[model samples]
Target: MCNDSKIHGFLEKLPKCEHHVHLEGCLTPELMFTLAARNGIKLPDPETRPEFSSAESLYTRYENFTSLDDFLSYYFIGMSVLKQQDDYEALAWEYFQKANADGVHHAEVFFDPQEHINRGVLYDTVVSGFTAGCRRAEKEYGMTTKLILCFVKHLPASDASKVFDLAVERGDFDSGVVHGIGASSSEVGPPKDMFKEIYATAHSKGIQRTAHAGEEGDPSYISAALDAYKSQRIDHGIRLIDSPSLMERIVKDEILLTVCPVSNVKLRCFDHISQVPIRRFLDAGVKFSINSDDPAYFGGFILHNYCAVQEAFGLSIADWRLIALNSIEGSWIEQERKLELLKLVDEHIDKHLAD
Candidate 1:
């Protein structure tokens, strides 16, 4: 681990933006209990406890997963307590409070409306709660946020299309606060091409696009997502480096890679944090950003993500600054807002170094 206090200081002060986190995944155990008690929900006993319940243990006990399904099984349980608009509002508020505490200036959070809607929760109710919390965060905490409605790849493409239509009908895209469509969930089913029509519909309505790819699959999936979904960014694209041609393509296209390090360790993607290819990705000049994919389930927020990468990679102050720049480059914010953020990042870095 690195002992460079100077670099650590820079990392903590660097203005940051997150682009790959899930709202449901932000449910901390303390919040989980609060929501459960209020909603009259019950979690399984320890004998049948999901592995992700160990999330409360800082993910120290989740080392036995043999497959993504095993990881997701526990992941599903972690989000089961949410049942109403108040539940969603509390989840969003809690997540932003943590993000604000971590110095996150802007964030693009993913939401799975189907997770609630399939269980009979109203679509308007889901958006109302989330948007209310985000509005409150901006007014109260000074955090800027954007929402992305993500399609569950494990479900049929038709179902995703239906939800996409619902999102548009609800004026999610018209509001500018909800700006994009994303494909997430298990990557094993429903080829990326299956959602081409949905992406097209979203595009026609002026929504931007992104997709999850290359984390647990081959680089070809990344290609399909880009080609079919017309994605502007790739989430968890760590596997792209495995194929030099694909890596070259990513750089040439300027596609941003959103990386979540501690989550990778907890999910057993690599045996050690130092094995993460963050430096390698940077050296290759592939545009990328850092994020805590699921802070609650993975046991860290954006600051922890930065600190973990810094300690594992032994990044220098310059390296930390480069990462902050990459985050600005990858953000979907308007040019005026992005410039404002860049100025803030620069000012923060300068002030910290001078201190």
Candidate 2:
């Protein structure tokens, strides 16, 4: 590991923006137990559900998932413990505090409404609590946040449309709390083309669009998301490197890729962190940023992701600066805020050099 104090200091001080984290995925086992007890829900028995046996055992099992499907089985189980608005608010608030301490000044968080609604949780309860949590984070930690409602692609398009309509009916699209729409989960059958109508509705309402594509899907999925869904940014677009033409298009269009190194490794997208192709993306002029897709499950947060990549790739201070700047630029925030964060990045880098 590169343990140079200067490099560590630079990473600690650099301002960051995390664009692709699932709020539910941020639930740690410690919090899981706390929330489960508060809600009077009993976690599955250890004999039957060894994954929930103990916090340490759960983490060990989390590290052993053979595929994305395996990880999600546990992911949904973690969601079941959350039943009320207070639960949701506490979840978001905890993430904000941890993210703030990690040097994240801005975060665009993803949440799956259908996951909660299918479990009998109301959409109003979810949004109201999450929005309140964002306000609290801003007030307490000066952390700017925006929520993105991610439609699970494995679900029917009609179901996703209902979620979109709910957001629209509640004026979430205009509320400034919910800033965008995204597609996530099981990118196998329901292609990005499936969400065309939903994206169109969001665009019509002036909400930003983004989607998870090319993590395990083909490069063509990335193309479909860009062309059909008109995605402003792509989450986990690491496979774009497979198609040089598509990569060129991404660079030309400047579609930002929120690449998660630890998630990629944990999900078996890459055999090791060194094989993640971050350097290749940099060389190709692709606009990309580091993120922690499902930090709790993937065993790393945004800062840990950055540090792992830095050590694996032996990234210089200049490289770290570009990555930090790309995160702010890729964020769905106002240009004024983007510029302000960029200035913070520059000042941090300059301070490190002077030291």
Candidate 3:
């Protein structure tokens, strides 16, 4: 964003909290091949899907994504290789290392259990591996993590309900193995209230909730998530700008919007990073956190997302401080942990801008 090394250093050191990154989305092409070969899984022939030939070729294909569904096609292909608990653990550890290097102190990650269940991978395998990775992150990097089991919305609600029942049977929410639930994938076609009953159950039990809204869909998608799903946070609510009243309501309620800059441009939601409306949201008093929704596919990680926003908007120190605070506030962590993050931000502000 700035030529000044001091400002750049400050951005690098800022503690980040990502709420929208999907664990499966972090499956890099290199890892996919390793796991595929280890598990004896067959990838599509090179003639039909040339991207399967090599990691380099697959990454080249990632650069030309035309839409969310287009990227998802490749995303699911990458997940085919993750056949064992170790594979899932490796995938999360890989992402956690990168996140730690980028200064992430806390994270609420998303994973689709239904997708894995359909693949014949047991739910316990997925949770244990990811949970193991999270524990390692906490021990080694001192970073806390919360897992959010996301439902593949394009799948039948009956499928999701079944998964929900399994989660309840396992006491996933009550025991905190999974912190919450969210709806994702194919946002446009799914009925807005498809997960209403599930949300009602979660709300009745006082569990946390969130959803992907207003990213590929319209502002009404965001409203439905609130009115119907009663989500505490809105993931990718960039389209909230289209509805003034919705924007007002969001500000009044202090609902956090997890906005992904590079993902939006890659998915063609916006033509360029500059079109992401960073300054608009800041000026309008809308609380939002910059994230890399699917960094492996979208071409950047959390720091890369932060750099893109800064390069586009040249936001001042106060602006960045606010953004960092907004992210911390939106994090579904304990109040004591939230206070610690706030203290870190204050230290960074003093160290970086003390000149």
Writing each residue's lDDT as its tens digit, candidate 2 over 1-355 gives 2377667667866899999999999999988998898998888898988777889999998888777777888888898899989999998988888788789999899999998988789998999888888999999988889999999977788888998888888888887768999999887667559989988877777789999999989999999999888999999998887899999899999899999999988988889999998899888888898888888888878888888888899887877877887788889888999999999889888888887
For model 1, what is the C-alpha lDDT against the true structure? Answer: 0.81
lDDT string for model 3 (1-355, tens) is 4466777788888988999899999988888889989999998899988888999999999999999899888888788888789998999999999999888999999999899899899999999999999999999999999999898887899999999989999999999999999999988887978999999998999889999999989999999999999999999999998999999999999999999999999999999989997999999999999888888887778988998888888889899999999999999999999999999999989987666
Candidates by TM-score, descending order: 3, 2, 1
Candidate number of the best lDDT: 3
lDDT (C-alpha) at residue 174 in model 2? 83
- Looking at candidate 2, the ten consecutive residues that score lowest on lDDT are 1-10
List candidate 3 segments past 4 Å from native.
1-3
Total backbone collisions for each predicted model: 0, 0, 0
| Clash pairs (backbone) in predicted model 1 | none
User: What TM-score does each of the candidates earn?
Assistant: 0.93, 0.97, 0.98
Off by over 4 Å in 1: 1-5, 45-47, 50-66
* Per-model C-alpha RMSD: 2.2, 1.2, 1.0
Over 1-355, each residue of candidate 1 has an lDDT whose tens digit, in order, gives 1267776666666788999899988877777777767888777765565533533552554445555666677667667788888889989998898888777888899998777777677878888899888898889977778999888877778877778887777677887757798888787665757789998877777788999888788788899988877888999888887899989999999999998888777777777778778989989998889899878766678888888888777776677778888898889888887889889988987887788
